[model samples]
Target: MSGDDILELENFLPYRLNRLADAVSRRFAKTYRDLNGLTRPEWRTFATLGQYGSMTASGIGAHSTMHKTKVSRAVAALERRKWLTRTPDPVDRRIEHLRLTKAGIAAYREMVPLARGFETDLLGHLDEQTRRAIVQGLAALEQAADVD
Candidate 1:
């Protein structure tokens, strides 16, 4: 194959998406990290619990697209901070359900506004039509990828 047939790394859709995701994640992480001293995984775990009420670590991992080990460490960190509690599943001896504590809930609530602000700031750079186009394009890409 000629060099003309080779993919350009900078222009590749997957590479661009990954780079954008990383940049956005890091930008948002500053809010939670500065205010709550939470790592990305810990903040994700906490947010998942806050949104879903109660779930197993495996569930959190699936929802967050995080590995099992990352989820475990995040759970442990949140537990240490008294931001989460674990309860044994009634029907499953080995399964433990996790939920956010009152403190965790408070933190999540506080962070929501900050997150919204960050999103607003980022999207503000685009015009209304551009923003809508970007959203529609992302939806189409997700559909094409069979993402849930």
Candidate 2:
């Protein structure tokens, strides 16, 4: 293959985006992990239920972009910790609705301010113009990617 056929990973958009996403996730993970020993999927599952009240495992997976296995594991972990309750549907025993328990709500409330602070601090590094540009660029990228 000639030089023209070679793909430079360093200059690739998808690679750069993936690296940025991983770094950001890790940074935020430290906040919740330190407080609750939660993994990324666990945190995502908890936060999704906290924000949206109750939902089925498949619903959580779709809403959070997590795979079914990840959602199942997170839900199981949270249930074991007594942070969430799983109630079987009245008509469909196979379907279970997951909701944050009082303890989980308390934990979520505690994290809300910290989560906001983290976002604030992260954005504080950028000037207003750059921040607006970044937000616009990301919105455009999401649209282009057909992200719902």
Judged by lDDT, which candidate is best? 2
Q: List runs of model 1 lying over 4 Å from the truth.
A: none
Query: How much does candidate 1 score in TM-score?
Result: 0.95
lDDT of 2 at 131: 95
- Overall lDDT per candidate, in order of appearance: 0.93, 0.96
Candidate 1 structure quality by residue, lDDT tens digits, 25-128: 99899888999899999989998998899999999999999999999999999999998999999999799999999998988898888888999999999999
Off by over 4 Å in 2: none
Give the clash count for each candidate. 0, 0
| Whole-structure CA lDDT of model 2 | 0.96
